[model samples]
Target: MNRLAALLLDRRLVAPDLLATGPIPDLRGPVPASWQGLSRTVSVSEGLIALEADLLELGCALSAPLRRRLAELDAWELTIAGRHIVGAMRSKVGGHVDHVPLFRGFPESVPEDAFDFYVRRVFTVLLQEPEQPCVLCGKVATVHPVSPCAHLVCRACWDGSDFSACPICHRRIDPDDPFLLVSAPDAEDDTARDLVPHPRLRLLSLCEDPWAAAEKCVRELLSGQAALRPEDLESVAAFVDTCAPRSARWLPDVIPSREGKATALAALLARAPETLPDLLDRHVDTATDVLRLLNAAMDGDAGLRRARPIAARCPAGSAGRCWTA
Candidate 1:
């Protein structure tokens, strides 16, 4: 057994019956006339395994083990050769190049972002419940086929927006194709019954409650469990504004009195220190005091320290004078 075949068999990525026998076909020649109408070939090489594939040519380097394995299989004809050759070859031989594994075992030849979109938005649709609600607006959806791709979007969401393409996959919609609607009544029923709020709606609710939202944001930032989404930052800012209203203007004095408030302030400073002076000037009577407190809080934290320089750029009237302290 060649090293490549042994590795693939050990990893369970390829079954023994799928192994090709004899010599690896040289694919460096002109395309065959019979294979002219099929998809273009993509080549991938990893260690001792090399594969070249188009619709007609699915060629792989055969190791001794692979050849022996093929010889032993009574069902060899019913394996990868008899199935979808291109896809099977891609799944089997496309792993690493120059010792670096491709994204999630996909070939480096595949466009990462496009393949990700295809897998996540297109392929995963098959696993989705027939009555899955619209991801946006939490509405019961009548699934309409978005064109130029196989992505489905809710009719209400599609009609509500002026989008010429799918919102999720960003694929162009075909106006010529009839809108095929698959009713998702269960999703609507769930929403109508209020059994559970949609994730987007839950986020909206959090944004509406500034204090609670700010606390949640601070906890997320401190834990380092997951990075905050762009929308989370907006919610955090809204919460900060609510707690330290621009007119009230006494942030440093009030924030230190509560642990949660202090942590939230520190998290905000850590996240966008460039906005520090502006935030303090807008919300604090004593911006210098706030700057000092923030600097002290962020003293040993690497992530927060990276933003210290930007915070130091605060204007003279705000934190510039106290920055040196």
Candidate 2:
């Protein structure tokens, strides 16, 4: 039996009685060459989907667009040998040209919009949820983010002290990088609180070397205390690659001041720096451009140039800039 038929049969969508009906007038479209069963058939200019009763019911979960198309269609027309299906037309023409061809589920090339929509949705959901337990320490925290190296760490595994670098994925994060504290549920304001900059807590100053802090954050991600699913981790790693290069230097040091700042930043990427300094040089320009855009919306004004969210970048050598950097 065809996979679709098997799927339908398993779901109990079609009855055995219908199966023996000898190719009922299922005017779906040109049936697949492989379909075979009782002999009777119909040939419509268009093709139709032939699914078991349960399989048709399962279609309810499909995206709104696909479901709508399926819902508007009429019955599936069986092919003579059962190898093909004839689809019914919403509007029938007098001539044979109205017949539609059956298509393989897989298309040679998908529309750009459709492909992009799928890719974005797939990665977005993957990053948010994984099918398997985290690969790092194996703890099961529901809210884990991936490190640059693609390890899934739990919050408990990363209590913010000691060893840097993800144990499983091996992405490096500085111990001193500022981490955003989750807002307390009772707190009225939802603004994120930085772990650094506590007046009495001198050890956690904003001036703490950012690279070291980022390394620490990466370590926490790999420990599995904040566990992320393996697939989710991979997706986050993928998201990092598509993003443009970001500045690694101290973000607070480079907020843009006036007009023409965006143009200046585009020029800075050409200059190279060694180690952290190089990272910082790249960071300066990226940071300037971002701040200007954000501030642009202060009075309900629209931003002229929107900066892509910084969370898309590799979590290595940079973390102090906040989640949306």
Candidate 3:
């Protein structure tokens, strides 16, 4: 297994040459028979710009939003592959690169956002009566009960015993659950391991403009179908405060969540004091929005949830200059 872990995949597995040439990915190697006359390097030199589109055409197993992020790149270099592509054969030229691990496969039955689906699933399972409503669809139905925990599932929605834990309750079942067997010698008693699947590396590179690179990384976190996680919201606010306090494009045109709006708005206010009136007019939809923004500025979670709101110097007036709160 260690040997396998150390093994690098053939760079040809998803060759840039064949991918850019055709409408589909195929068993054909990099260069086609017709293109045999052209310089191989010249032909593929268009370089992986259509990468995301090609992957989508190939029916890649990645989730929807992830596909866009995985495609974000400025330039491609073979030398830098080792940094982001795990077990990648390093090239002569290199810089900072980071890897995003992709699970081999998981439930793709629904088009829901994966993280949002998991959280809603956990809540849906915990709060409802076992047999009253289907855990996934939330409809009252004739449900089949999984053993021991008796978490009712719509069998149509779930494949039985495919889970390491009760699909509904997220707890251990008896020894006979098809996913595990105490009788097997190699059954290590691991419950949480199910969440951590064997991952494949997706290579990511930064954009040349450092601000654009920072914006893209931060934007990916906010572009998800779900609201920013409480912890993640705090981290984003802190990061933006340090990085892009004044760039309006650093955030989306509309942020739907309350915590996200407040945390971000406050960060801008603290970092760039001139950020107020115009930003508030653009973002604040209601009185409550202003209150949350002010609350974060005035009395926050000790600046953990946002940047410490700062005071801007008052402009000189005919009357006199005085500091405003």
- Which number leads on TM-score? 3
lDDT of 2: 0.28
Q: Give the CA lDDT, 0 to 100, for residue 100 in model 2.
A: 27
Ranking by TM-score: 3, 1, 2
Report the lDDT tens digits of candidate 1 across residue range 80-195: 32122224443443433111112112222323233323223322232343344443444545444445443344666665246666554344665556343433334333112221
**Ten consecutive residues with minimal summed lDDT in candidate 1?**
197-206
C-alpha local distance difference test of each model: 0.34, 0.28, 0.39
Candidate 2 residue lDDT tens string, 1-325: 2323222222222222223234443334443334424243322211222221111111111212222233333333223212221121111122433232232211221122222222232233233343323334443344233333222345665643575764432346556751322223223421112111111110001112323433333233333334344443332222221121332222233322322222222222222112233433443355544554233212111134454443222233233332223
Model 1 reaches what TM-score against the true structure?
A: 0.27
Candidate 3 collision pairs:
79-91
| Pairwise TM-score winner, candidates 1 and 3 | 3
The RMSD of every model to the true structure, in order and in angstroms, is 20.3, 27.3, 17.4
Model 1 spans > 4 angstroms off: 1-123, 131-142, 159-257, 264-325
Model 2 earns a TM-score of 0.18
lDDT score, candidate 1: 0.34
What's the residue-level lDDT of 266 in candidate 1?
44
